[model samples]
Target chain A: MNARRLAEEIFVPHRLVMIAVAIGLLVWAGMAMRWHWIPRYYDLALQGLWRTIWLLGLSCLFGFMLAVPLGLAQAAGPRILAAPARAFCTVIRGTPILLQLWLIYYGIGSLFPQFPWIRESELWPYLRQAWPYALLALTLSFAGYEGEVMRGAFKSVPGGQLEAARSMGMGRFAIFRRIWFPQALQRALPTLGGETVLQLKATPLVATITVIDIYAVSSRVRQDTFIIYEPLLLLALIYLVIAGALALAFKLLEQRFNRGMVG
Target chain B: MLDWLYALWPGLETSVGLLSLQPPGWGGNLLRGAVASLQIALGAFALGLVIGTFGALGKLHGGPVTRDLLSVYTVVVRAVPELILILILYYAGTDLLNQALQAMGRRPVEISGVVAGIAVLGIVQGAYATEVLRGAIQSVPRGQLEAARAYGMGSVQVLRRVTFPAMLPLALPGLSNLWLIATKDTALLAIVGFSELTLETRQAAGSTRAYFTFFLAAGAIYLTMTLVSARLFNWIEARYRRGQVRQ
Candidate 1:
């Protein structure tokens, strides 16, 4: 297609209409802010944004760490080990993350109160906090997803390469460290990047459990000010910007990893 | 523990009473809530199928503008967290439309929970569905279309008889996945005070404080629904694939 046609196709009327509607809503929101119909709570917004960032960062770190070994085990372990791991992955994958969060936060807390070790530990205080519950839920959920992605990537590594490494008299650990891990990491980057973006979006669910993320803050702003769309629109725009940037960064990383493969 | 297990076996007799058909009993309420959840899912899935089919068609055939439009729609809808979408659609949807109508000197609008739930879920499902449908349509052999044209079939006729039927077998699996997602997302609609199974379970748990029992029951309901639907999808898939063979 020609450039003009391409542009036109990309800017189709339905989408344009939606964007126009969004812009109109934003303009109305701005007017609401100007007239003090919507309160300007810059501090809360900033704090909420920071909380969102921290939640995503910590959750992704923990999730990825847990995922790597679990994924490797699932891909390579004996039947006894792999069966339970596979079942764990399947159950986590099949169930709703929100339900899992609710169950862990409330059910475990209420059920296991009499366990002395749990009650006496320093970790109790952290575990008792809603944020930790949120973190645990997000981490476990993403671990399941990323584990599957890693498993696929590991399987995709050519058998000949591993055989070649073994034939060269390299130890298993050395071969895995030098050959398998790097190649699998490269192969898994795109999927992992997508999951990271997903995790960013998923962090807002933390607000439902009272973790005071950006969406929660926005909801509070709406509740306090009785201004409906402004806070949500602003929050949505912030999310869009973050997600779009992540998409671009991942695309660049993918291209870098794929540099020599295509040509 | 053995004695306790024996007692619990007889204690299971009261399980029926626990499921009795009255207030303070779960049987009626849980069943009703499950039905409502199913209704919400069905509505969302139907709407998603409609939106997805058209969106996919536009993406595949409408040129670059359409493709880009679909791309943005898919990206934005998918990237925005489902919970946030539910909240925005549930609360702001009502307020914004009502205010807009009032500003226009018209009657105010009320967005019902069912409508809001379906709208949000349908939009969410459509994002994935668009990709599925687009892929399925693109996978249809170009030669088939050319053959149809040679037979003097019009575009509409070709779509109806040749393209759509061919796409259906390929699209069925993806559509099934979207259906499962929509079904699961009905759980989120409980936040908006929808009397779905999850909300009913929450209410039961709050009142009885048997949080474990109620939540376990809710999980069971979800699992049952998922398994049943999965079987149904599998049957349909088998039926669809009957005449086809692997090359």
Candidate 2:
């Protein structure tokens, strides 16, 4: 009758069966003739997996680096700077990442011919490459979202702790370095981890802009071989594995950071 | 300044021309595409809302068999990429269904772009919606439900009159956010050759090679829709909060 008892009774056995059935179905699917399509293009699939890793890793690194400064500024800077940064966050958050990608890759690229300055600029060569454009768009978009998370984390650091550091003759930068940063990082990790996983899923959108990520390669393989589901199913499996690893790493990090909290 | 203006004018003119609603203009195409996109998104959202509400309810109160099945459905849909889902549904959904139906001695059926888009997006949205609805339902006060039971109200009566109303306030913000996501996701329907705004913009860009202008316009349109919806949601939130105060 109580909520806890009901939850335990209903959820425990159900979850076990769910896990078992999922694993059984996956193994059965793996062993079936349907998997023949995968072996024929094993090399391509591997290449696709490699590309997915590379893109997600580089994009996340770039995005995190951009996010930190932007977030800090948005939180602590003068209104003039913070207002625009806030607006940037709002606009980016409000729209679709797909349109952002298209705007940068095809939309901006198409302007090069008309803008003589852009055409002649040294950056044009780099901008012409699809990967850079995809990377740039992804970085900017993630920066907007992660900036908000970081701001929330920074704000969550207790005022009393900050004052204590200040009273100990710690300068603003030193106080931030020694106290604020670590605490904020710890508080922000879970949300950041979730966002990173979401970003990993978003890597496939780069395929639309012709980045040849895993999804692109899978589609190419499907097109070349006329095997529809196999390549996609394999790609989905690889994504699941990557997401599982990320989730595990985040859990470990959370546990390590969670020490001394309760006491 | 005049020279800069002159240089930009031609491309801008062409873009505006393309987006015009007049015959032989690309604006008409984009408008039609926007309508199709809206239809798919709205249809998907409606279906997803239904599935999500039921799924959340089932996960909360259903038997073990139902709970496990719903959880599996949610997890798989959440894990799989939206684009992959769209591709699978476009390519295999109708065929698989037709094969099963034929074995049942029913005629084979073709799934249209609209139907496929709605089905795929609905399934995907339903995954997130289940979480949203479940959280909202859980947030409703246990005391309220207990009070309803004290008054001899059955589960159905309590759900209809008390639980649903309380949950609506909590659920509206999340549902609006999901609606925006659904609208944006219809962009992926472009791969299936659905004549959504994104697809129309792509075609116009490809044909004219005025890609920058067209896409910028498309981006502006998308931003406008998002901004308007956000304001609308704010208004709804305020209205609901006022109603709560009166209650």
Worst 10 residues of 1 chain A by lDDT: A30-39
Total clashes, candidate 2? 2
Local accuracy of candidate 1 as per-residue lDDT tens digits, B1-247: 3567558687454544556678657868888888988998999998888899889889877876577768888988877878777767767678788999999999986677778888888888888888899999999899999999999999999999999888888989988878888887888887767888888877777776666666767777777787788889999988877887655
Chain B TM-score for the candidates in order: 0.91, 0.90
Predicted chain B of candidate 1, TM-score versus the true chain B: 0.91
CAPRI class of candidate 1: acceptable
The interface RMSD for candidate 2 is 1.9
Cα-based lDDT at residue B244, candidate 2: 75
Give the distance in Å from residue A135's predicted Cα in candidate 1 to where it truly belongs.
Answer: 0.4
Candidate achieving the largest lDDT: 2
Can you write out model 2's per-residue Cα lDDT over B145-182, one digit (the tens) per residue? 99999999999999999999889889999999888888
Q: Model 1 over residues A1-263: C-alpha lDDT tens digits?
A: 68999788648677677778879976876665643533367778788889888888888889888887778888898888778777777677666666777777777767666798888987888776788888888989888888888888878889999999999999999988998988898999987887888789778877767888888888887788777656776777789888888889888898887777855
What are the iRMS values of all candidates? 3.0, 1.9
TM-score of 1: 0.86
lDDT of candidate 2 over A124-194, digit per residue (tens) = 88877788888888888899889888878888889999999999999999998999988988999999888
Best by DockQ: 2
